[model samples]
Target chain A: MFSGAQVSLYPMTDDFVGVILKAITALEPYRPDFRIETDDVSTLLVGPPDQLFPAMRDLFVTAAGSGVHCVLAATVSRGCPGEPDDPICTPINDVHYGQPLEERIAAAIQQVEAAPKTGQIVAAQFSLYPLGSGHHMDEIYGCIEFLKNSGVFDRSKNFCTKLRGDAGAVFATLSEAFLRFGAPQGHVALDLKVSANSPTAV
Target chain B: MFSGAQVSLYPMTDDFVGVILKAITALEPYRPDFRIETDDVSTLLVGPPDQLFPAMRDLFVTAAGSGVHCVLAATVSRGCPGEPDDPICTPINDVHYGQPLEERIAAAIQQVEAAPKTGQIVAAQFSLYPLGSGHHMDEIYGCIEFLKNSGVFDRSKNFCTKLRGDAGAVFATLSEAFLRFGAPQGHVALDLKVSANSPTAV
Candidate 1:
């Protein structure tokens, strides 16, 4: 089965460019575990759910820790027979695939040091495709149950949830649910978007 | 504050038209209290959250009772100073609004008597905007906590949660959160869409 996700992050701050750079830097440690690609619209991560979900949790936690509203939009998929089997999709065997985490962070900071700053709420939307699972509905149900138990879901506005305060707890809850849903047995796929520090409805 | 939501419903069965009509008819009783309009793409409901949330709950619960996969996408909003003060946004004072529930259902069924039939999974997406609240973030956070306690949220895929099996419970959880967010104190607004009986990821 092919499993992967595309994610976009928006930090609600005057220094949104810097904040976004910081978030990308936060994921430097896990770059070796997954194929990470960044474009103007989003960052795409291709890997097994085990690596992808945790990396996502870390990224969100780090971004949210800045005390600015941030919205993350992502679409996750598994069991995609149509997806290509490219180098990016292939698993990495290297135990050490990149530079040290500190070095990566330093490089990222240096790269964005000259960027302009603006304070704006980040609004994003995503869709996930968990295709070809006979028990797709069941997996969705299970995943929802997990989120309800995680204490981060905002039920008032459809599937959009809010994560605030105590970043450690928020990350733990989010990662746990992601890992469980990515389990082989569930055969789940997900799509999502979150807006943090948004001044208006996203 | 002007509060409203836009919803789209998809039923995973071939009898989608009938199912949708049935759901709409279910809300006839509250028509006077809410300004409800239906176009090709979606149905819009505007009113106080107190009345609007419960009405939506009943409609979704009735639709989900068919044992077919359904997805609802909605965007909810409150405190929109820019929204026009149209009749739809106006609160109704009528003691008697529309026909009795049975008559409305019968009418809806008759209108869709020629629809076809099939079974599939429903997929949908939605966004909610609870604007102009000093505690907007806090209210969102509170609503998320409420959903986490309610046991219907799926934490694995950001805010995307699933609703399956036991239509009653699903509706209850959904309505409760909507109502809480729509509470007068929170000054919230909402928008949404729903799909039932769809077969693919939405």
Candidate 2:
């Protein structure tokens, strides 16, 4: 079963996708069985882990050559994003790889909680590109709604409460989320901070 | 005399550029005098900083709301990337930002001589990206040529005989070279490393 992979390319511009596409194709020699489907700026590849890992390695090496920088979100298990009706038979969730606003927030919170410090707020911030490509406001609203209803966080809290727990638990949750939304070669920056409430130079 | 303000928006896909344009135009109320241009995935806005700041602020706010995460790079300079015919009113060689890369390196070495730890190279790495549009191999050879001619790094006898500077410095140099080549938004992300040899993180 295939999971999700999220990738990011720096100097993100029009021709970056071409470079990413080229990198994916180059990986075919390494992971011949995986299917690669690209739509606009995002791409999805589904296959067994053994094949997928090599494919990803080839992608990184080739992208680096093209001045591309990428981050793989995680390996997924079920669902993949493709054409709406022609959904690819992959194990990654389409919603997570695309405009994964809600899942990202949840993952951020989970990551922070997993590694809480004396005066640190474990937090993650994410950016998305949903202005075009038929992304509707309703779908975004639904994601927000689902997040609110997921009961993962208490909405009634005065401020977003900091969840305290083991890093393993937090990581597991984040890993699960990554499985759903990670893409092959898109730009996503994940900063794990143990910043104090008041600023102090590191 | 408007100190030109430059705004570069990078979208993951060309299709997303249209919506980004709409968001930028929506900021017309905030920056009425803003002049905008699009050549590929980058949208360059040149105008007065007073008006440009708010326009940029508005555009980022809307983009965030729309789920498009962006990494913004800006500068307020005396000249704009206005037109091809316009002679650069600002002197090209002024070290307005900082000493030339070579000068900076020399100063660092001298300072390190006084205090050995100052020049102690902590880390060093180098990377390149194509200039302008980045669809094809850019003549980054010019940057390589600059580094070679500048006598910046002592190829021998130095504890850290390598390029280790801030990511910003590296990019700025590369960007300047591309501009000299008459390529707008044709740039690449430089993979760099920092050392105690330099002042900032590479």
Candidate 3:
């Protein structure tokens, strides 16, 4: 059965939701074995992951159709807001693509260590997506729970993630975290530079 | 004068490139300042930053216009391929957007940091966007040079980059790096999930 998912599109912060809506509408012609819906913020299409791929291709091809050029982001899922009927309401670990928050937190720490500048640790800020404002601490604590529950690593000491390594390592670490969280597949905008104390390698 | 920056989109894999291309094509109407040039493995779009933003918007709209959504990686830049008469033949500290190899490497780091597994440390497996195809080391080195020269942060020992506090600081540091070496501003797509990791104070 196709999992019901809420797919939202962030188009550089604009009321440009119509494009995706149009694509979703176009899917009707394909006779997909799934139910699809569209709104201003996202297009919720329901179907097996396999079926979704082809329908998505058609939508991408026509809407983002060739000869046009632009950047984009999208998501797919099932379930509705209100109450907690959807499996997504539960912690990510409980979901199909979910990874324990502890795993994510540990990954963040390891990411810091893996940075190209592993020895010289500096200012680093790690965050979980969709935690929303006024709730970062609560969200972080939840992550700790996942960590403790999962016998992957021990959170014996006060574990705070600090970015280490060179620019390369720092950037690499960030990517891993996003993937682990099952970040909505989208483009990545990155900017990184080497430290001044480093050699004149450039 | 308009900055003729070259923007190249490098998807994690060749398969992903097709989707990216569709997103770009959909953006064509909006991105008047730039022109798209397609190569075998990548697509190059040259234009100014002002126009690039909207173009990027369209691209993301188109991608989100589809169903696959995520911000795996994205970048912006201020330079383009050098002319034969160009004095430096691409300045050692120069950063441009047309290059994909450098951005891909940077993105690999980002994925590592964001993923919840692998300890968030980008293993060699995820070190390069197009894994196993070694090329563009010089460009990567160029980015390192640009980061060091650009006075975006304080020079701390190790791989530390001193910036303002929290989100602003990270944003600023990344902005400088992208403006100098990133491709035209655009939305990137990747799979991301927002989860609460911390436990609430019961």
Q: Please tell me which predicted candidate would have the highest lDDT against the true structure.
A: 1
Error of 2 at A74 (Å): 17
Judged by lDDT relative to the true structure, which candidate is superior, 1 or 2? 1
Candidate 3 falls in which docking quality class? incorrect
Off by over 4 Å in 3: A1-202, B1-18, B69-76, B79-81, B84-202
TM-score of each: 0.39, 0.26, 0.23
TM-score top scorer:
1
TM-score-superior candidate, 1 or 2: 1
Question: Model 1, B26-107: lDDT tens per residue?
Answer: 8988877776766433456877554665576667767766766554555555544345444454434221214433343333
Among the candidates, what TM-score does chain A have in each? 0.61, 0.33, 0.32
**Candidate 3 per-residue lDDT over residues B21-81, each given as its tens digit:** 5766766574444455542212334454334433443454344333443232222333221
Off by over 4 Å in 2: A1-120, A123-202, B1-182, B186-193, B197-202
lDDT (C-alpha, whole model) for all candidates: 0.47, 0.33, 0.32
The lDDT-based order of candidates, best leading, equals 1, 2, 3
Report the Cα lDDT for candidate 1: 0.47
True contacts kept of 3: 0.02
